[model samples]
Target: MKTILFLLRKEFLQIFRNRVIVAMIFVMPIIQLLILANAANYEVRNLKLQVIDQDHSSWSRQLVGHFTASPYFNLTGMVASAKKGITAIEADEADLVLHIPSGFERALRREGTASVHLNINAINGVKAGLASSYAQTIILDLHQEIMPVVELPAGLSSTFRYWYNPDMDYYTFMVPGILVLLVTLVGMFLSGLNIVKEKEIGTIEQINVSPIRKHQFIIGKLLPFWIIAQVELALGLTVGWLVFDIPIVGSLGVVFAFSSIYLLVVLGIGLLVSTFTDTQQQAMFISWFFLVIFILMSGLFTPIESMPGWAQQITRLNPVTYFVDVVRLVLLKGSSWWDIRSQWIALSIFAVVINGAAVLNYRKTD
Candidate 1:
């Protein structure tokens, strides 16, 4: 009991003594939260549009007006010919080109249907897809407005309501996931480097020759990081709320409770890495390799359901995936403990298995 406390004290002292680490512990979360929450957005905006308007009619000009009025598009200029519009796209000056033929207004008035050619640069697939979708929607809206109203018998109509994120603000969706990432990074990188650093500096030799038992030494090494990670999580959540206006719809206690177990899983991974590696650099490289795999497969930036079947199955093994789901569910959807019970159990099992492996692998003497 007293021995573990003494070891914890020693670890905390060592952590605070390093100026760079202290700054990272306090500063990194705020900077990352502020920047990434704003920068890592999926919403496509400010697409450059060049229009080739051969139709010098009201409907043609009205269609051009629609593109100019939209926030999603910036109409660079009106070209006299389709050739010029194509040249703009080739020169990387425009993302999309709208070509309105000379008979466009006549076709709309006579046949009630007009075709507008859209030439979109497909260099960035996602941007192209979104820009195409947005332009199509705008054109469809104008078509509906200008066409004569037809009375039809009412059958069924569907209305969409976005539940958690009503405004569809990307920041709301990203902040919680980014918070989980920050906590995971601090726990894994710092704890993984701790023991290996001691080994490098000839301090592990002294600890191995001491009276400390294996589990006690592991606990001593793990607890400081565990506590620091929780503090980091709390700080991150606060920043998310204060800076980004992210709401915590669920119980804060539930958040902390789940975080306690999740931190153990992350810290256990670090300790396991430390047990196998002799130097901090080796531990860092190994930790980063696993971290990248875990984060990418975790559904932080992309939907796991959209992944291939084998890739989705792989995500089931990633601990970050579960935490990301749990945090978003709790903070965004106001999910209760029962809602996250399955994730909680999975993380608990991971905590036991990983920490057990780390302890078994650690030799009392070298």
Candidate 2:
């Protein structure tokens, strides 16, 4: 116990001595959160719309007006010819082109039907799909307003109620996930770098020659980082609540409880990576490789359901995926411990296995 406490004190002293690393541990994540929370948005907005209205009728004008009024679209160019609208799309100035055919209102009133040509830039498939969906919704709303009797079928109506995120704000969805990322970045990178920094400064050999046990050294290394990561997470969540208006629907105690175990997984992986590498560069590259894969597969930006079956199966092995899932489930959905029992259990098993491997791989004499 005395030996381990000595190692812990030494590790903390060394950490506090490095001003640049100390700043990185505390400052970088907050800056990343401020920038990334606004940037990592999935919601499609400001779609550049080009319109060619041949009919020039009041009804056609009203439809065009809807597109301009909608927050989803910006009418950047209006041309008399379809050729010009197509030019705007080809030139990359517009994302969508709308063509209202001649006699659009006349055909709608007389024949109860009209055709509108929609040309979309399909370069970015996701953005194109969202733009199409937004346009369709506006068109449907316009149809119900103009020809209420024809659009409705004997009192059949549909109502949408959004749960959790009522306004469908992207920040609400991204902030919690980003907080997970911030904690993860610190846990994996800082812990991995801590041991490697010792190797670089020649203190690793000095410690290995002393009568210090391996487990004591490893525990000393992990404890400081675990505490630091939790502090960063608390600060980040406070910032999220104050700046982004994110709500903590579940118990903060539950969040910290889950996070404590989850940090074991992240710190264990970091220790494992450090054991295999001699230099900070090697540790950083290895950690970055896995962290990138974990973040991408974690469904932070995209939906896991949209992934192929085999890819989704691979995500089950990723601890980041479980943490991201449980964090959002707890914070946004107010999910109880019972609701996330399977995930918490999986993470516990993962922590035990990973740390066990790290302990075995760490050699005192090497």
- Clash counts for all predictions: 0, 0
What does candidate 2's lDDT look like per residue over 1-366, in tens digits? 998888889878988898887888789989999999999987888999999999989989999989999999999988878888888999998999999999998888777878788899999999999999999988977788876745533246588999998898888899999999999999999999889888899988998898888888999999999999999999999999999999899878888899999999999999999999999999999999999999999999888999999999989999999988988899889998889999999999999999999999988864
The 10-residue segment with the lowest total lDDT in model 1: 149-158
State the weakest 10-residue window (summed lDDT) of model 2: 148-157
| Highest TM-score model number | 2
lDDT of 1 by residue, 1-366 (tens): 999999999999989999899888889778988999988898988899999989889888988898889999999988888899989999989999999999988877776667999999999998999999999888976766676543322235455889999998898899999999999999999999999999899888888998889989999999999999999999999888998899889998889999999999999999999999999999999999999999999999999999999999999889999988999999989999999999999999999999999999999765
* TM-scores of the candidates in the order shown: 0.95, 0.96
Q: What lDDT does the true structure give each of the candidates?
A: 0.91, 0.90
